[model samples]
Target: MAREKKYREAVNWKKELRLFPGYLILLIWISFTFVLLGWVLLASFSTTKEIFSNKLLASGLHFENYVKAWINSDVAGIFRNSLVYSIIACSLLIVICAPAAYVLSRFIFPGNKLIQTGFVSAMGVPVVMIVLPLFGIVANLGILNHVLSNGMLLIFLYIGINIPYTTIFLMTFFGNLSRAFEEAAAIDGCPPTKTFWLIMLPMAQPGIITVTIFNFINIWNEYFISLIFANSDQLRPIAVGLYSMINSMKYTGDWAGMFAAVVIVFLPTFILYIFLSEKIIAGVTGGGVKG
Candidate 1:
């Protein structure tokens, strides 16, 4: 028993030693992160004078900062716009990518490898290269002048830009699934489409969730695209709108309000991570990892 205990301890020591570097880096990262976010949160509640003096929240909890930011900056309009864009873009990406991924992963068809390779290649192409010609074409079409058409165009761009990454990600996860599920579904007289819709998609939930969260964050925090496309203040998303507000803040000197705006803008992604962190971990580590 003593020898057995010693062997176990020695093994654990070696394992811990091997992991020490990762643990140390994570600890440092977490510590710095908490300090920064903590300051930001407190600064949001503080007066501009207090923030500069390094005495945050000394004036008591001023919820008014949030109110001022929300109202004065017209955050509600931009927030709603971002929400609409993200929700629509994410839903469409899933609908379009999931089936494409499944078909690519499961079937042996002509051009399958080519299609996969194309998607892989597309992922490497930077958005900057294509934005110019695309923007020029849209301007020629004369639809960018209209609000609904402009919004639809933005959604289309988001969906098109994300398709390769989303498809590849879900394709890998779909590939990880055992053929047993499909086999069993076939034996039960289920069609391939039905089997995929009912069985395979649910099985790929973790990956779907993770990818959706990523797409949501990307679309929500998207700056350059929205800055270029959203010509009207009403159509502007939070990222572009926030930039405009910050620029105005330089003259208005509403530092507290700006911090509050930052917090409000950051809330959605933060809530997403908090709620779905487990799924993200599972999705990242579980990706059809074959033995």
Candidate 2:
């Protein structure tokens, strides 16, 4: 028994020694991230000159940086644009992808495998490939800068880009769902559509919420598409707006305000990950485990 125990302890000790390098790497990364975020936060409260001069604030913090960014730079409007675009895109993605995933998962039909393969392929395709053609089509339509038209077009583009991945993500969840619920619904004379809406979907809440959170963060931070499609100052989402602000900073020299704007843009995603990280992990892993 003593020999066995010593062998097990030796094995564990070797394992820990093997993982020491990974632990050191993780610690270094965490320390670097903390320092970077702290510096940004501190700089946002310092004056523009102080930021450029590598001097910490000896004077009191300036709240005016936030005010200037919010009002003077139209960060308020840009923030609203991001919120609207993200919410609309995520809502539409769920509405369109959910039923399609359900049908694909539950029903056996012709070309089902082909459709699934197509969605998988779509997820792998880079956005750069389709941007030029999409831009040309939008330009030719003369809907370039109008808020309503641009907003609608952006929503459609977001939906089209996201649907394939969302559908495939949900398909795994749906495939893992037990058919007993459907059988029970059918036995109770519930229609197929009703069964999907009322029974299976409710049970798949975890996966749905996870996917929605991901889509929200993705659409919120999306830059290339928004930059190309909604280039107008009035319609710029936070990502593009911030990029414009960074460019303007060369002339305006409002480094404090720029850092403040970056913090504002980063806060929502940070808050989301902080609060729902466990749920995201569970949702992503649950489908594979359930199947």
Candidate of highest lDDT: 1
Candidate 2: lDDT over CA atoms?
A: 0.87
Residue-wise C-alpha lDDT for candidate 2, range 18-117, written one tens digit per residue? 9999999999999999999999989988898898889868577988989999999889999998898999899889889999999999899998999988
Model 2 misplaced stretches (Cα beyond 4 Å) = 1-22, 281-291
lDDT string for model 1 (127-237, tens) is: 798889988999999868999999998899888888888898899889989999999999999999999999999998877888888788889988888888876778999
Q: What TM-score goes with each of the models?
A: 0.88, 0.89
Clashing residue pairs in candidate 2 are none
Model 1 spans > 4 angstroms off: 1-28, 281-291
What TM value does model 1 have? 0.88
**Candidate 1, residue 220: CA error in Å?**
1.2
